[model samples]
Target: MTSLTTTQRQIVESDLGQCITHEKLLGEGWSNTVSCINNKWVARFPHTPESTQVAVEKQFLYAFGKGSPINLPNLKQTEGNYCLYPLLDGKRLNLEEAAKLSHQEKQKACHQLGEFLSWLHTSSFTDENLSTAPYGEADFYQDLWQYVAEALPCDLRLKAEAYLDSYFTTVPDEERKPVICHGDLGLNNILWDNSNAISSIIDFTDLFLCDPAYDFNAFYSYFGQKWVNMMSETYTPHIGDHFWQRVTFNKLRKALFVVYYARHFGYESYIPGRIESIKESLSQQLI
Candidate 1:
């Protein structure tokens, strides 16, 4: 466990009104340093001013507390750039553990997750201060395609360009209505119970309003097409045909986003695998 800064220590002491008896680093991600404090609370420190995750917890998370189908964090400190919450129970599901689940188990998890997402998307939780999504269909395709064009080898780039041409002409923003999105619904952020059902969905740092299909991107990336199809079958009645098209767009955008940042961050080794995945996701027809 890393030592807590004096500021962090004081923040906890001030908030909890007790000395910490135990502390340890729980995990670190792109924007926040998460630590367990006194074996009961999670202290999250944002390393960058751009990390408005603390604000997300303060502004948005509480509204989802009672009615939300899955567990959400209950904030302990609400008035600062750093946030503290009760330590949530459950293990984060890794790829190996996820793969080990039986088909019935997988379907059960997918079904439950699907139902939770359906409620999240349809919920009347609104905040005027919440940010709009960074990309619309046209912009998502165009910007990410440019990133793909510059990053990929010529052969792959050509195929990506062809897919982009089709997407730009076929799917426009007017065709799809926006809904609130979880922003970064990656596997690492999802917590699972011993029975393999989802216990909690964490990290609302990237929350915004966008196509509901964007929420399915992480599920597709980790679970594959069949799993996505299963989840979609349940959600489709709410969204209709534009749902799969948005899913394809979101998948491609995520891939290009990975490549774009990987190159920017000099993570060259990741580009090849990400590029292949990009190609595969792009090959799907805009449903």
Candidate 2:
């Protein structure tokens, strides 16, 4: 049996004629509560106001799905605050499962993912449905710094502040060319098949237009610089000379957010690892 709020229960019951079975919670993300119904359909309910981006995400899927190099979810149903789709095939990979793959397999996956990102970043698709936040790279960094200031230890917070100051000076707004970002393209959002190949990418709630290097922060977080460089080599001319610097800055931003919100966000278990990753990312910075 699966647990659902009255709203979710009513929606599912109404859609499936009260014969729905095998309901189980899949997971909760920053903005949505997701669950499976009868092992066939996945239902997502907005956990926060931000989750309402589902409607726009659906439009992106429709606009880009046909020519997408990698698999993406197909919109199946939408009702009020709930959105439904067929459960995509394959399983999400954890770090341990990903490490089990041979180097060649990992490289192959990067190549494939690189190709997918290139297609995504270079897409000409535009819409009034997407976010129109009037922020550049510096503004975004400032936002992250403000959030992390209270969360991180004094020493780490100071270091992060210095990093941001230096980054803003060295990499100015003129160098930034905004591209569509998969906002939260981390390990959890990626699905892998039996052969360790990418099956599909999910979760578009954080989709926004920002520096293309912002997307590579996930590579540093999940697979480190080696794979990041490998993927970059295949991603083409889009990655710039200061790409690593950009990636490092973005990684710091993410680490700070997790550190600040861990307990409050119900992810206390993830704090230690996230802090360590922040340290490592800071150490690797070329600045």
Candidate 3:
């Protein structure tokens, strides 16, 4: 049997909202059903059972946005299975959108995002008022390596594991800077308003900490080398030079992550693409 399409998901969302008339099917994301709710609100709900994730996206939105200068999505309310995200005037903000903006606007947006991430990483996450997990720097990478070793093809997977081991072996644990990290940070997940500014960050499922470089991995993937120099200039003026190594590590680690997900999820189509990305990382970072 085929899985539910966007139309079926719209029905489910309409049922949840109890709307009289269902409107357009806005877009279908990697794991969620997205549709117009009451022609005003956009309702995003998980389509697959494995989709509900560890990171508390809604919780992060509430906590992270409290005093943030950059805007994240404002949470409206939650029904049983769906979350209501307020409508923004932004369009699809993949790297393609950056080209439409002038260099100055791009510069402003990059700086704003850099500052936002800097604050997120510097801010501590404790269990005082919120229910959370304890994370250590080495623990995060160890877990990542384990996941990759189990997920990728035996040959590629073993090589990647050894690569990680050698990289960390020379580095002392005490030298690692611990900070909160956005487990997943990239262009597809960011939204920009009509004015060419990032208006909302939609997904918050992959929240964790190991290195802030993990956050900037998206730069190489989506925005291309064209963005690297500009991004470095914008961030260094504030946070200092601490994230590049982590970013390089993150780039390689994430390529392994792609293989891991494909193996576990049985998404055959992803394997080829992931292998290609992994090869790219090996050529670039393994030297």
Candidate 4:
């Protein structure tokens, strides 16, 4: 039994037919409400007011699905503005569970994640439908540097920019070139099952072709120093970019995005946490 807004019910029923029924609302998400529909599909609806960026996310899903380690729900029926996808196993991947995995399982998980990421960084994603990643390294720092050069009034943005400039001062622009990165690869976005293995991935709204450091740090940001050191040691040897250059470059760049997000679409309570993180980001300038 689908318990959706009358308009929503109409939309789903029209798309999938009345023979189908929605049952068990999985949960509401930041941008979409996900529910099990027709017993086999997951119907994701952008809440009222709609997420204009949902289309961009749909595009990212196509790319990510191509490289995912586990089975992912391909986009199925799209109605009104919402999309329907197959239901992945409804489970979450977290550190507590990651810790319990056997050594072999841990290695397998890391390998799968690394391979998924390698596909993104190495693939040439130039097509009429998808924009080619921007050219060269100067282009990488250009926006954030300009934002800082203009010296915006927002303390967080300005502070983040200042730290960015100092960090880039040492590393050459040519080394800061872009790579495809999972711009927001947090625990909540990844799905797993009781075996503590990755079942599927969700949320491509923050996907971007940018510095690979941004993706690598997700392990640190979501878990802690332990994972960070492990991943960095494994990944750094494979990277071509100046290490610190990419680190600070993407950290502050992403931080700037955070402020931009907080100012507009985010909740009031989010400001303080973002502000604190911004300050912390500024303070970590060793390069």
> Judged by lDDT, which candidate is best?
2
For 109-198, candidate 2 gives per-residue lDDT tens digits of 888878888988887866665663422223454544565455556776677678777888898674567778788887888988888899
In order, candidate lDDTs are 0.72, 0.73, 0.60, 0.59
Model 3 Cα lDDT, one tens digit per residue, 1-287: 12345665565556555642545667766556566655666666665444334235566666665666666667654533455666665666655666678888787777777777767777766423232222222344554456544545666666766776766775455435545666677777777777787776666655654556667787766665566556666553233344455566767777766555556555667777776666666655544
Per-residue lDDT for 50-92 in model 1, tens only?
5454575567777666577788888774566777889899888
What TM-score would candidate 4 get against the native? 0.73
Error of 2 at 265 (Å): 5.9
Q: How does residue 184 of candidate 1 score in lDDT?
A: 82
lDDT of 4 by residue, 1-287 (tens): 44467777777777776645547687776456777876787777775445444565566565656565556568864636776777777577567776677876666566556656666566554333232232112343553244333433466556655655666686665555556565676677777666666677676555456657777665655554455444454352366547645654555666656545444445546756765665565556532
Winner by lDDT between candidate 3 and candidate 1: 1
Candidate 2 runs further than 4 Å off: 13-18, 49-51, 132-142, 150-159, 172-174, 259-287
Assess the local accuracy of residue 96 in candidate 1 as a C-alpha lDDT between 0 and 100. 82
Error of 2 at 237 (Å): 4.4
Weakest ten-residue segment in model 1 by summed lDDT = 133-142
Query: What TM-scores do the predictions have?
Result: 0.84, 0.83, 0.74, 0.73
Off by over 4 Å in 1: 133-143, 172-175, 259-287
Q: For model 3, state the Cα shift of residue 21 in Å.
A: 1.7
